[model samples]
Target chain A: MIYELLEKHKADFFVMYASSKDPNFYYAVSMKLPDPAFYAIGEDGTEILVVHEMERRRAERESRVKEIVSLSDVGFYEKVKELGVEKALAETYAEILKEHRARKILVPKEFPSFLYKQLSEHFEIEIVSNPFSKLRSVKKSWEIKEIKKASEIALNALKFFLEIVKKERRVEELRRKVELFVYEKGALAEDTIITSGKRSADPHFVGEGIIEKHVIFDIFPKIRDSGYYSDFTRTVIIEKDEEIAEMLKACVEAKNEAIKIIKEGVEAKEIHDKVCDVLESYGYKTIRQKAKEGFIHSTGHGVGLEVHEEPKIFNSEEKLKSGMVFTVEPGLYYEKVGGVRVEDLILVKKNGCEVLTKFSDYVEVIP
Target chain B: MIYELLEKHKADFFVMYASSKDPNFYYAVSMKLPDPAFYAIGEDGTEILVVHEMERRRAERESRVKEIVSLSDVGFYEKVKELGVEKALAETYAEILKEHRARKILVPKEFPSFLYKQLSEHFEIEIVSNPFSKLRSVKKSWEIKEIKKASEIALNALKFFLEIVKKERRVEELRRKVELFVYEKGALAEDTIITSGKRSADPHFVGEGIIEKHVIFDIFPKIRDSGYYSDFTRTVIIEKDEEIAEMLKACVEAKNEAIKIIKEGVEAKEIHDKVCDVLESYGYKTIRQKAKEGFIHSTGHGVGLEVHEEPKIFNSEEKLKSGMVFTVEPGLYYEKVGGVRVEDLILVKKNGCEVLTKFSDYVEVIP
Candidate 1:
């Protein structure tokens, strides 16, 4: 995939530091290293990893790449002892690029400004908007399997959370139980939202206080072994009110409506529009009608390496293909009545979409 | 602090997206928002946050700043509808800067290159290596309190881990137990290293396999509410071998030696050299002597909002000041005998240093 990308751009090298939080670095190297080490794919599709002396052995052992060079090989520590870390890194990287005969370097759009300034002084640096993003949007069989495992772990954690929510009073306690459950299963459940009542109206609010009538439980866990993630949201009702029940019903319906339109070669915007149309028909205002209220956010987004990646199922013109995996979430929020969101992972199939999250969205914990 | 920085640099504005992972964005706003929204500090010290319409209410509620504007207020959504997200964001940001009359912008050195290109076309851009790093380095009273709390939580978690390690047979199981214990206490223990035997030789290796003669356990947990981190490392011996015991003693001694010299106005490099001198005297090669083996990494680093922050206590010339909290870690590794590391958080005082981690470094688990 990277070879095709480099060839198409006619670039001499696609250089990136594994240190940068850009997912492309991991995508190219297919390994996770602690420190940000240098990684590049040469014009002839030769992959190289330049790491510190301490990381050399591990890089050689763990990374899929064939050639792993130590920083000392490029005189990094000696240069650092003389010129300091920043200048030494810049010089060492420049030397390595020169060794590869790299004249045109294609870097991620989020490339570090300091490094860009240093590299641009020696090479024609082109800012590419994550050359691997398109490839990452379409999940491979292994990637799908990882996501499935992550989703299963999240569902189990959710089940544990629901069990606790029935007994636990505080939102913080419930959140802790969910997080610990996920961690025990070798996954991370960070930013798990367990908001109640009016606070649930805010999409990004990681909730607090006592568990109330309308509770939002959004669990997104990253699988430890594979760096893939699964996001699932379900607004549970404890002591349900009619208004809250109506909102929850509409949210689930809208989410299903969006999922129904998922297939190969489907326009992302069409799915979003389907969600908005369903919610609006149910007498809910959307971001399309008003800027600040009702169904405010996008229907969903592609989820893989990052929680939110490319091929956003918003008002996008991009068409979805068969291998693409994303989320089909539709939500409605009322400032007075709180919010209800139903989200599930969707894998685009040749004819239809597979809802990867097996747990039912309409969870009502009647305590 | 941001106002002072902008005035000192004589920059019209310091613009950044909340989306950027730079901690300065959160430091500037004093709020945590999920999405990357527009944020700027004007020449007149007017702190402004331009967020998505949905996030506007919460931003207003949560952020410490006075002025919080929605994207719609700047006609961002309409522009996005007309143009697209990328072009519209550029135009919206350009207009926002123009409204502030910002002709000169000082961005963080790690600023996104793609954004730099867009902003540079309109303004005089200067890349500043973390404008707030120096300020963040000096821990405030509240910040110190937060760090203290995080360290306490980590100590408790470490105690829990030690109890489990005494019982558990596998490194993976012990790591999972430690991680779950920390998460249950409202802190994240990601990448908690628990490597055994030769695998412990690699500092960054998050270890695996069964209980062995020597094991390295490095736990760094971020406090959930405060976002402060505490790092602690302790190499334990399952069955005490003479070589492993000697190495552990030397590591603990080296760590204490570095900590003993930590006071206000002490050069960071002197502390690093002290660790090196102690370790070298114990017949171990340092990074200064050889790039790869023995004590290869830096002695320690600053612990605050980020795990590894400024005031790196290494071959650094920067002097430590009162109220600066950091780590004093010294370790020695051999390919054949595995590694031994002893780390503890230190708070620089007017007279000396306060070791924040209360747990004893010496541990011998008999199976």
Candidate 2:
């Protein structure tokens, strides 16, 4: 598929750095390597990996590439003796591209400017948007299964959190428990937002102190082995008020309305508009309506290798395609009443979307 | 400090995307944000943060910057309507720079080429090596304390692993146990290399399968609250052989040699050379001597916010300075006897270096 994409782009080779920081690198190599190394795929479908001597054997074993070359094997030391380490590395990469007879090399858009300047001096380098991003956005069936598995683990963590969220329970303690549960299951739970009362008004708040009124338990865990992620957000009501109840209902309805329109050919913006309309109809203001409160964030976002990937399901003009996995999270925030959000991982299918997250939405937890 | 650096460079402003992936971003803002947003520091020491409407409140509360500008306030929607999201973002950034009467912008060396090209069209954009990297390398007393805390957690995790590395125990299972222990303590243990037998011969191998005669357990965990990290590697022998025993002794000696020379004004390369000479004198081949096996990697690297930061101690000409913390790891690898490595985090003081990792080197785990 990458070869086809390369051919379509009229490029001789697609080059990227195998740094775990870049999801495109992992998507291309199919495995993570600690050290940043040169990875290039030739038009002839040759997957070449150039790594340091220390990481050579490991890269050979883990990377999906056919040819693995060590830096020492390619006169890297001799080059370093002449030039500095940084220049030597860039030159070595350029030499590798030259050896491949690659005149027109396609690099990721996020390629370092310094490296780009160095490589451009040698080759006809074009900064292309991550070619594999779109490909990775539309996950395979096994990828969907991996995501579902992660979602299940996250749901279980959420359930555990809900069971323990007493009136006097500290948000930090609840977060720690959730993280421990997920970690024990060989997953990583990070940036968990367990805000209560007025603190929950800020969407990105990683809450602390005693639990009160509504508690937003947003658990996003990444499965350790697969590097796949699952995001599940549920606002649990400990002592619900009339306004908070209405807000919760409106947020849930908005999320459902957006999910209902998700299919192979639906425009992402249309679904976003639907969510906004639903929220606004319930006397809630949205970012689209130029209001500071209510649903301020996007309706959803594509989730895959990275927690956030391409094909954003916000005010995007892109059309949803089959096999695309995204999160449908409609949240309502008020300065006085706190925040209520219900998020679920969804897999867009031919007919509709499959809600991978099985956890109950906004639950009233008895304190 | 960033403003001072910017002024020193004769740059009107310094700009970066506030993405957690870029340590410099977090270093400048003193906060972590999920989404990538615009951040700029002017010559007058004014720190400006432009974030999404949803993240406005959170950014205001968390970010150290006094001036927090929401994207919506900057006519982001109007700009997006005229130009695409990407172009609009760049345009808005350009507008911000123009508003500040700035014509020159200094960006990090790792800045995106695509963004550089966009910004360059409007202003003088120079890709500068992270000016803050040098500052970050020289840690404060509090930073040293944080790293020490991380080291203690990693040491605990390592001890837990040594206890569980009995015969018939899978390396993956033992690794999981170590990770779970660290995660429970609010630290992240990632890329843990627990290789046994021939697999250990590869330094970077994250091992699998049953425990053997020799196991290399390299635990590098970062503190959850403080982004500081501690890296420690110790090769344990379950049923020790003469070859493995000798290798362990040589590695320990090499590490000690490197640490002995670490002090203010000491050359990094001299320390590296000491490690190489010690390992070579023990009849082990070093990378410096152009050998495939034995002491293949650098003696050590500076450890801080990122595991591997500035002031590289491997064939580097830079001199060590006080308050700089680094790792002094030396390993010997052979196809026949697998691998043996001993590493310790050290803090360079005015007089000498203090070893931060407290775990014993080369433990013998009985089945």
Candidate 3:
């Protein structure tokens, strides 16, 4: 894979300067580093890692790369004395690459600007797309297991949400309760949107106050420190008002239509188009045709190390492949009727998709 | 302040392309943003906030910026149809600058590289240091209140740590219990380190198993969603071991020695030098002299929106000022004796420093 990326980019080596916060860098090195480190893959697929002396021991123990080098190995302190911290750091990076005899290095588009400004003087650098994103879009077996675990935690949170909606009538308190419950289950529910009534129509509003009609509970909880995320949304209709009954029906139809066509070799955008067609067929407007109301947002996005990642299921022309996972949700939002959405996580397979979500799409709530 | 920064940089306009995750951006806007937005200040001190149509309403309501504009207002749809989304976005940003007749623009060093690549075609951009970090280094009265509140919460967590260590009697479980207690107080304790015995010599190890003679508890909890953080470290002695008693004394002496010199008009590096001097006087080597065994870290650092920020208390010459908040921590580690650290939150005033930490340095556990 590393050789293929180097060949595709026409690079002598792929140099990634990033921290653990960067999902691509984390995916590449298979470890989380709080500080910046250099990870390089040579044309011959020889992987090298460069780190500070302080992190050298941990890198040797935990990093997947076999040939881990420390800055001290390259005379960092002497260089710091000669050139100062900023210049010495940049010079040391250059020295590492020079020792490898790398000429044309490829860096991700998201490379640190400061490094680019400093390193561009020594070598010809090509700013290319992050090779890891496409690679990470298709999940590994272990990664899928983690996602499935997160999904289970999320489904439990959904059940907890339903249970708490009655006792904890206030939306703010109910949100806190659901988040605490998720944390106790070894997952973190950050920014879990629990919105209701007219405010729910805004889509991103984290609402407050007593429960109202057409409440949207969108929960995307990540398993603690694993980077795998679970996303699920369900609009609970309390007291089944006639105003939003048709909107719910249309959303469910659109969601089902999108899911029906997902399989290996199918274009991802076709799913979004089908959702749009289904929603438009119900006499509702869509943003695809430049209309502001109705289905205003994109159909879905790939969910992985980052919450919204590659193979975006909107206007993408990328073919669906096995091991790709994403969300398929369709919603109808109106200021008066509020917002109604039904979402589920789907894993692409050979013939069809395995719906990772276990929760049912039941709408009516007695409370 | 804006005018002073503009004059200092000699730039026609100040532009910040950032998301809420950037503390500098959050400081400038006085609000949190989930997505990237454009913030510009003209020479006339006109603050313009540019956001997507979906966020325009919220920005107008919540953002401190007076002139809030939506992308749609700048004909984003028409440009997207003609030039595509990426180019249109860049063009619109340039369009705003052209409208202000901006000749030179100053952006923070951490500006998005991809945006820089696209926008450089239109304007001459100067990558200056983040002006907001210097401004944030000197805390406001309200900001000091938030930090003080976070400090109180951290001190309470320290007491809870004592309670849990006796009941739990295990390193890993105690770490989790302390973190959970902090979370219950509406703060997040992430990557907390509670280590014992020789393993504590590693300094950053999060250890497991029953407690040993010398155990280090370093708790840094952040107030949830507020972006304020509190850092406190205490090394507890089980049954008053004679091995690490001298080490603890040296650490406390070094910490107090650093704090003694902290006040307005003092160079931050002098405090670090004083700390190193105290430790060396006790015959302990420091990192400044290239020694790895004893004092191997910086004396302290500024604390505010980011846990570590400007006015670095290291080998630097930045002068201290009134209203600046920071930490005074000194630590010593040896393989046989284990590690000991004493850290406290501090606020610099005109004449002296305020010890924001209320917890005692008493190390005896009696367990």
Best by TM-score: 2
Candidate 1 lDDT, tens digit per residue, B1-367? 6677777888888877646355777777787776687787787868888888778778889898789988888888888878767668878888888887888888887677877877888899887767678788899999988888888878887678778877677877777777777777777777788888877888888888897887787888888778889998887777878988888888889888888888998999999999999988989889878647789888888999888887788887898999998988888878888888999999999999999997777977777
Candidate 1 chain B, which ten residues in sequence have the lowest lDDT sum?
A: B15-24
Per-candidate interface DockQ score: 0.67, 0.80, 0.48
lDDT digits (tens) for residues A47-75 of candidate 3 = 88887665666677778999998877787
DockQ for candidate 3, please give it: 0.48
Runs off by more than 4 Å, candidate 3: A77-84, B75-85, B335-337
Please give the distance, in angstroms, between residue A149's alpha carbon in candidate 2 and its true position after superposition.
Answer: 1.4
Evaluated on CA atoms against the true complex, candidate 2 attains a DockQ of 0.80
TM-score on alpha carbons, each prediction: 0.94, 0.96, 0.94
Candidate 1 regions exceeding 4 Å error are A18-22, A81-84, A157-162, A239-242, B1-4, B18-21, B81-83
Better candidate by DockQ, 2 or 3: 2
Q: How much lDDT does each candidate structure score?
A: 0.83, 0.84, 0.81
The residue pairs in collision within model 2 are: none
Off by over 4 Å in 2: A1-9, B1-8
lDDT of 3 by residue, B162-217 (tens): 77777678776787777778877888777788888877876656677888886888
Model 1 chain A weakest lDDT span, ten residues long: A16-25
Q: Between prediction 2 and prediction 3, which has the larger TM-score? A: 2
